[model samples]
Target: MSVVEVREDGPVSIISINRPDRRNAINQQVALDLQSAFAAFDASGQRVAVLTGAGEDAFSAGADFTDLPELWRCIPTVGITTDKPIIAAVTGWCIGGALVAVMACDLCVASESAKFSYPEARLGFTGGMIAGLAARIPHKVAMEVMLLGATLDARRAYEVGLVNRVVANGRQVEEAVAMARELAESAPLVLGTIKRFVTESIMPKGPSELMGRATRELGAVRESEDGREGMRAAREKRKPVYKGR
Candidate 1:
């Protein structure tokens, strides 16, 4: 099975990071898989996506230190860009880098047992993307989490606007999927328009977020069929025919 799994239920695409043994921590492979998964979701007929961790001991225990996954690559707006809405189904522990993804999601449903903390400052390093949390929630609260490494339980996260709602332990995903189903039935074009306007116009983008977006765009072009065709044409001394994919 894939490190990250993607399945469809009508217009909703559910993507799960499947490393429960590691508390669903994101490793290098998992990051790449997640990046690819959302890219596919963006190109798919799915109107909404629910991002969750498989087997729910944790949404993720942050990055897997053994491989140090490129944490940015799996973050919602940062690594994966879609005009479609994406909801986070957070379960159990959401630590360190995991907060970045949860914060960036358009809507978040957290399990009551969930606990979110960002200890990167104490851990002596950070991806720095979490800085955007201040823009999403109150500045002081974001600062508290970042500077003091404070933890937020699901209820507190909702009160502070970090999460949209909180539900019982195993019902987080179910709740998120219910939300997704509602979104799925809405007008896709209108939803996409509003989401894009907020993401590109209303929300502020920090340096790391900007860089992540640029990197994601670049990576897309580099991995596209046209990029390969261009290289082949250059080697063959002929003009490349671009597919504009």
Candidate 2:
């Protein structure tokens, strides 16, 4: 089966992350598939796209750590521009780079069991992963998520405006589809125009550029003592020891 599945339901196109065993983690292929799905949705008669994960367990666990540096650098919609409207239907464990995808969506719906976090700080890099957090949610909430690496449940995510709706567990996909259908009922061109107008004016630049700049300026950080130490600790399944490095 394909790692990413795209199906059309009349005017709504549903693009699902189909890696349940890995909690729908984004890898190089997944990233490419997601981009292709979105592009198809944009080019088709479909008026809206609903993004979700397969199974009832997870929306996405984030990027596969094993695919870091190279593959992890290419995230779907992170820095690219699109005129289409995509809605996120989150179920569970929407953490790390997965949250970045969620932030990229125009609207988001989460199941009660859904949880979110940004652990890239622990991995020792900042810009490429979460450049959209502050723009999507409050600065304080963004800071807490990125710095403290704490998990935010569905209710809290909704309260902080990180999610548009919070449904009961297992109902996220249903609710998201309903919302997509509703959005599809509108004039497609007008909706697209509005989406572009608002996003271009308010949304920050593409995350790819920001991350590219970050990777260049922080090249030393990747080779720093703390960077190597953090990787070692993670490999050994222990807390990382950071000694001013």
Candidate 3:
């Protein structure tokens, strides 16, 4: 089975982390799968996406302990560059790297049973992608969650601007999908412009986020058709015209 699952709902695509056995914990393979799933969504006809985990027990227990991923590679805005909006439907525990991913999304919908935490400071290790949370939400609240490892329940998360809406546990995905459907009906160009403006011009990026964006852009160039053409031309000792795709 795929570590991540994708299913389309007209203009909205639901991308799920299919690891209920691991509580949707993100390992290296999960991270890579997520990157591929979202990249495909961005390039497809889907105008919006709702990202969620398989079960209601936990959106994610955070990064897999035994096999920690380069978690940044799955985070929105960082690893993937798309102007299309992503709405996170969170239920249960959204901790560590999970919190980082949700905060980067354009909007978040959390279930009443949901809980958000960032315990990296206490764990004596961090990827530092969560630092951008301070710029997204209130600094004190971000500091409390990151530094003191304070847990924010759904209600508190909504109040602190960590989540856009709070709903019943099982309704998180439904509500998020409804929201995405609404967005899908809007002018795609306008939505894309505003999203790009806010994320690129308004939001501040942390070091890890900056690095992730850099690598994603470079990888795109390396994987482009023009890149392959150039390589093939060099091998044949002939000049090649580039399509600039």
Number of the top TM-score candidate:
1
**Residue-level lDDT for 201 in candidate 1:** 97
The residue pairs in collision within model 1 are none
Query: Which candidate number has the best lDDT?
Result: 3
The 10 consecutive residues of candidate 3 with the worst lDDT sum are: 72-81
Q: Give the candidates in order of TM-score, highest first.
A: 1, 3, 2
By lDDT, the better pick of 2 and 3 is 3
Off by over 4 Å in 1: 236-245
Off by over 4 Å in 2: 69-80, 206-245
Computed on alpha carbons, the lDDT of every model, listed in order, comes to: 0.91, 0.79, 0.92
Question: What C-alpha lDDT, on a 0 to 100 scale, does residue 37 get in candidate 2?
Answer: 71
Candidate 1 vs. true structure, TM-score: 0.94
Instruction: Name the better of 2 and 3 by TM-score.
Output: 3
- lDDT assessment of candidate 2: 0.79
After the best TM-score superposition of candidate 1, give how far the Cα of residue 65 lies from its true spot, in angstroms.
1.2
Worst 10 residues of 2 by lDDT: 71-80
